[model samples]
Target: MSLKSSITGNTKVLCVIGHPIAHSMSPIMHNAVIQDLKLDFVYVAFDILPEHLEKAVEGFKALGIKGINVTIPHKIAIMKLLDEIDPLAEKIGAINTIKNENNHLIGKNTDALGAKVALLNAGFDIMEKNVLIIGAGGAARAIAFSLSKECKKIVILNRTEQKAFSLARDLKKIATIPIEGKKLNEQHLKQYLFHSDLLINTTSVGMAPNTNTILIPKEWLSSHLFVFDVIYNPLETKLIKDAKEIGCKTLGGLDMLVNQGALAFEWWTGEKPNKILMKNKIIEFLNLKQC
Candidate 1:
């Protein structure tokens, strides 16, 4: 173990496991909270592939590790490897947080609850609203599960209609809200965007450096709409900026990242991680590394 490791501390261990984890901000955001609160914890990233997930969890238990926050391709795969799944995680068919209680590996989905917190913090009241979600990736699935309880209707639009339909079908088994999946072609998207109370872009279309591509045309967007995009590298996506131009309330992925990490920290350590510290630390740490 590294000298800086808190493995010997009273608090348990925590890690994030994924492939291509070099770009992950989990350590920066989560470790800041650990330092700020003077908690005995260290959060690291394990760049393991899907095939290695079961071995990773087994090793955690063998090594007296406390818990982990999973991401990407491993989220769904880790579900079956865990001893228990939270209701929302079970409903969403995904896992982002895993807690190791001695030999038991428990699973939970913080992304769903995190998205709900992100939406409310963005001044959105999703209750009884018509919401349109873009992308059919893991993030999109989490957000859809989160909004299902509040939205009057949930419409998923994606380049791959089949994936969107798959997501809707999976979520319907858990959520009472009506869910619709459709292709995001010009005509179909325009119809949904204009009528949607909220437009959420979960795709990575407007990430860092590629900030010019708004998911939908700004002309079709209304000032009454609320927009959220899960891209934080540039901090603001083109969609968020266009939404701002049209006077639509908006949010970015940073809040979701922090909230979900916080929830995972709480789940493992039985303590709440500081949100502002987590957010600011991620920004500062990211900036410093770029320098």
Candidate 2:
């Protein structure tokens, strides 16, 4: 697909906002899809400070921005600023995509659905499986809540026991399956790793700048477990590497990232963008950066 040489005043704007937005691949992937579809839209990234979020959102409304993807610290904070939120997002307590419908911002969470899709596409069955999630943040909450419907049980493990318990308690209200929260320790690892069919790391422990660190001991990982780490910067985190070495199936966050962004793109443009094109663009960009 040919790139749109320039943006005109008529070019509708779509953007992603975060406190530290420099690392985002959203603009690269999204713009590729927009150009491929020949849409009159330009996507950009903005590093909006936490204090300036309200003003930034107001500016978006005033400027008639078509859509925006919220990342990082903004995901939860932006929820209160939006006019309305999707029921699932409200339940998950985070919103990643926002569509400005006639200046009334509508927030939705594509992360959960995106992860679910990615797992299914990878040939992993969530139904009747015991899932061990290694985080208590927004991503963990979203995945747990989304998988609650299909999985036999969910165990949330975090360094902070209370945070894990809080998330588990909140999710238990709507979850039909058994949910437990415990401190991420050797005992918990020994107890869950063998029985868990799936293990998802929503934490940033093995991301860039901390590339060598892995949350779980290599010996604890079983060949039967499916490992998923939501860290795409390194493409393969230490956890993913260790899991693969042990013969456990593994997946990185890039699939979820592209899938969620694709969902948001379709919702805003009412067209399904070429997802392969989007994924390739990110891979190419990351490769070039490495070189």
Top lDDT hit: 2
The TM-score of candidate 1 is 0.93
For model 1, the superposed segments whose C-alpha errors exceed 4 Å read: 1-11, 289-291
Question: TM-score for each prediction?
Answer: 0.93, 0.98
What TM-score does candidate 2 reach? Answer: 0.98
- For residues 92-144, what per-residue lDDT tens digits would candidate 1 score against the true structure? 88888888887788888888888899889878888899999999988899889
On residues 80-172, what C-alpha lDDT tens digit does candidate 2 reach at each position?
998999999999999999999999999999999999999999999999999999999989988888899999999999999999999999999
Backbone clashes counted, model 1: 0
The pairs that clash in candidate 1 are: none
Measured over all alpha carbons after superposition, the RMSD of each candidate to the real structure, in angstroms, is 2.3, 1.4
Error of 2 at 242 (Å): 1.1
How much RMSD separates candidate 1 from the native structure? 2.3
lDDT of 2 at 218: 94
